[model samples]
Target: MTSDSESPFLQSARRTLQLEQEAVGALISRLDGDFDRACQLILKCTGRVIVTGMGKSGHIGGKIAATLASTGTPAFFVHPGEASHGDLGMITPGDIVLALSNSGETSEVTALLPLLKRMGIPLISMTGRNGSTLATHADAHLDASVVREACPLDLAPTSSTTASLALGDALAVALLEARGFTAEQFALSHPGGSLGRRLLLRVSDLMHQGDRLPQVALGSPLRDALLEITHKGLGFTCVVDGQGRLEGVYTDGDLRRTLDQYSDLHALSVDDVMTRPGKRIAPDILAAEAVRIMEDNRITALAVVDDTGHPVGALHMHDLLSSGVV
Candidate 1:
């Protein structure tokens, strides 16, 4: 019920988003040799990329570490506060360190600089100030500076954090491409996610085979085909020849059409009503692809066939949904 002129919340929210968007845009022009050097250091490292930061920077560092890990780079987050106590041991001499500090002078993070230097570990710093202590000590410094904070008071870490996150994503994507990371490899890292299901869940994994498959002989009576469909609960049955090779498919849709054209359902056979050269899929294809085919053909189910054209299995729309492949 509030008017736009009186509602500071909506206006403030828009200003924040606009400022953050501009901050991210500014990062594109700032990319230079330092960014490439950071990528090279990470690529050459034999061990994991150890990320550390303090305060709001720490939250962004954790997300950056996760993105790097999931995108083929071996990376993990170690709190800078914890590093001073004993967590520094997690970082090995072979690892590369990515430290985040908006001011480039976080005490918790700077405290470990000398020790890491002595250990000969490469340091990559992301900071707003080019002349900050952390940036000065870093082997490669990435400028993640923002012109102003989204906060009206310019106190909260909003635009700066957003810019840092976008830069992290850029680095991860560059490294992912350099390593020739594939969707299959990504799926291996994210087996429980929807992307993993789409890339890894093949037709063979979800298809019904043997007695579970809804199928009948090509000469099967229309009643027999209907019973097969009812028993299997797939709403369709594949019709195969005497050699068990797929010949056609008879579904509820076909049954309705037959009923409309001819009232004698008992006298009809599968050969009379079945769709010849019905849509078929191989078992090795992705279940997502099956969904696409079913959608494209306006079908609810499909028959899985072997190289010899023999019916091996059946895939239903419900199976795709149940397995999270849809």
Candidate 2:
């Protein structure tokens, strides 16, 4: 490898980055009432937003469609060439069309303008030229124009495509906020990911309950508490009253403190060292909340309690980690 201080490859890479940055940056000022109108149109649509484009725009359109669909807006991409064929039937009367084209006169995309108009489907155009055929025929035209392509020959689609993708992302986010989309709702849309696991998995789902729960009476010998912690492998044990309600907890930290404060371990009862009212969570609460509670209090395990304050289960930080929610 050459590893030159000023390699031509590095120079080209930097130029491409600078141009693409400016391309996306230019979109900020162009955002106006048309952006709002486009959002309103999609939000009001009873059906999906049909995105169409030719060449590079089609690739960006596909990503835009995915973002919109995942963020609460129902949307999908259709190739302009395919739409000209029998695939135009995919677009229904209730649907809206979002067309992308840099030149704004791409024959394949522009050909659909008349058909969309006759069907009374609202059209939102994202193009480089506002006066171009596609933009002039649309209900709301989004200007995604860039100064020039990052290509040395100004031929390949680089800056223009980046700008279009950014605009698509802007549209999806604005519509997401306008429709009051939330993290919980987004988690529902993406249930296979880590965020979904964290949000959807409840404490009851991951907690150790019944026999597996480490628990003993408050007045039990400290030796008994240590045995429970070791047996359950949760590094902590819940100390309960005679009524089975949680009175306190004895953890590895408490064990260390006890060793420092007292000379004898067998001489103590759980009441001599257990932390009263240790951090607890309801079984119905989200496991993510349990994680937050553990994080804020700097504790590893939590007592899962019922409305009556009886420990029903036990949760450990390891449980969250193993579940891919940490």
Candidate 3:
């Protein structure tokens, strides 16, 4: 009779996690010359990294390829079975092949060895068996061995797959740093995602430009500036000089401060009450940078200017939030 405290289900789950965790930890000591050689081979390759595997290894290879591609390394996955069926045409002479197999005996993956060698393409093998045929014939071999599977039967691939995935991530990140890949470059590759929008989207993309911008000429009455702010709904309006260069900005906060200083607001000019040289950003700068500027200064709006400090556009906190740039 199994008691609730000694439930076999809970015990099995905990054991599985522990085994897999230990398997990944064990890989730390195995990082040696082979791992370094693999990275060097991939780094020097002028062409894309071609990842190939069979069955469960293939699924992990696909994810590895994706992570590498997204992190500034050009990589893609090709199924070993498909590679045998004329899909080997995808491999160019300049490319590097990364083949994954736990036992290093996957027939589909191993069968491509002769052709890869014949083509003079560099091959990096990731396998558990150091003496396996696949490892012996490779230019570089990455050992992804495990003591045992997390499975109670010790047959299913659980810990082995986890180790392979972690190793793949480590390789990709190392290469990314080696190449000096910047966030802007990463954003360029992932333009459709939220991260891309935040890093790549510039102030010009979200700002209200031209007629949509709320602006009043220098010396305009406070009443006119307030009306412009209300009409444009940007919470503020830029006060510009005769040459369109920015003079100041008048916001609701400025209005409150001015009212406290002077009981009569209508008699004053926009320049008199406006905050001089308020927070501003260039049109070409990142919207994320604009958000940082706004947050740092504790302001919600900013004037987008040109090289001459001329008011070109207006940016608001709502603009960033709505566009997923905040």
Candidate 4:
């Protein structure tokens, strides 16, 4: 009955958290035969998982569909109300329909039951009532019942929706594991995401190759090496041999130190001033691994080399950033 602003807000938040926590706990305990059967049905579905719901359940269904799609399970959301009109054509016999109805009586969702059955597509129901018409008609039922809603009126879908979301996540993770989904495969599905970049981006993809690579022969003047560095814009040049094997590297840092020791920058040879035995990586290494190598070595760039130690390409920290590998 506290009417004060702070007290009411805190009470509402606390109640909401408590209700959602209880809903999650309930869903965890209810993972029995029905939950296993639901997983089995989805695993065997060769086409996709068509999710349909109404109102608050519709919002949850959209999220569930997204999770399933991103986790290697092909799924899409269809509004049951729209399904009756024409969207139902999106579903086929190969797909399994997952219908959501909190009260098990949403007419919009219930209306699709007969059509799904006629197509021989299995129906998996997620609802609060185990004995409701939706559950009885479903090939598998997932109990998403909650003790109560966080709403004081006990009417709004607060806890029930949260439970549905958790159950959906559980199902997604289960499917992801069942399909032996690897990080590389997941990355292919999400090439624009950070995780995707970390898993799929290789050093060869971002490394400067061909004529863009900065290089200078042993005994080449420091001024010429600096020009190569400037032209390449990578702030460094590799010292190479007759066979183009890396002998050393001359960086901006090395140039600064060299300037203090010698005033004749034009006369100094790269072999005389270059840092010997510089760090290098294979062409096939991952960009993420390149980042780790740079961090551990406290360097900003790396020279990519072939098995014979020939400088093939160059990679910079900015390369990883631009590619979203870091």
Candidate 4 local distance difference test against the native: 0.91
lDDT of 1 by residue, 1-326 (tens): 44667678787777889999999999999999999999999999999999999999999999999999999999999999999999989999799999999999999999999999999999999999999999999999999999998988899999999999999999999999999999989999999999899999999999999999998997878999999999999989999999999999998899889989997898998899899989999999989999999999999999999999998999999999999987
Q: Rank the candidates by TM-score, best first.
A: 1, 2, 3, 4
Weakest lDDT window of 10 consecutive positions for candidate 2: 1-10
lDDT of each: 0.94, 0.94, 0.93, 0.91
TM-score of model 1 vs. true structure: 0.95
Error of 1 at 168 (Å): 0.7
Better of 1 and 3 by lDDT: 1
- lDDT of the structure predicted as candidate 2: 0.94
Q: Give the total clashing residue pairs for model 3.
A: 0
Q: How close is candidate 3 to the true structure, as a TM-score?
A: 0.92
TM-score of each: 0.95, 0.93, 0.92, 0.91
lDDT of 4 by residue, 1-326 (tens): 44466686788887789878988997877888988899999999899999999999999999999999998999999999999999999998799999999999999999998899899999999999998989999999999998888888999999999999999999999989999998888889999889988999889999999999999998887789989999999989899999889998999889889989997777778888899988899999988999999999899999999999999999999999888888
For every candidate in turn, the CA RMSD to the true structure comes to 2.1, 2.6, 2.7, 2.7
- Candidate 3 stretches greater than 4 Å from native: 1-10, 258-262
Q: Which pairs clash (backbone N, Cα, C closer than 3 Å) in model 4?
A: none
lDDT of 2 by residue, 1-326 (tens): 23468789888888899999999999998899999999889989999999999899999999999999999999999998988988999999999999999999999998998899999999999999999999999999999999999999999999999999999999999999899999889999889999899878999999999899999997899999999999999999999998999999999999999999999898999999999989999999999999999999999999999999999999999999999889
Candidate 2 TM-score versus the reference: 0.93
Query: Pick by TM-score: which candidate is best?
Result: 1
Question: Model 1 shows how many backbone clashes?
Answer: 0
Model 3 C-alpha lDDT per residue in residues 195-261, reported as the tens digit of each score: 9999899999999998899999998989999999999999999988898899889998998898899
Model 3 clashing residue pairs (backbone)? none
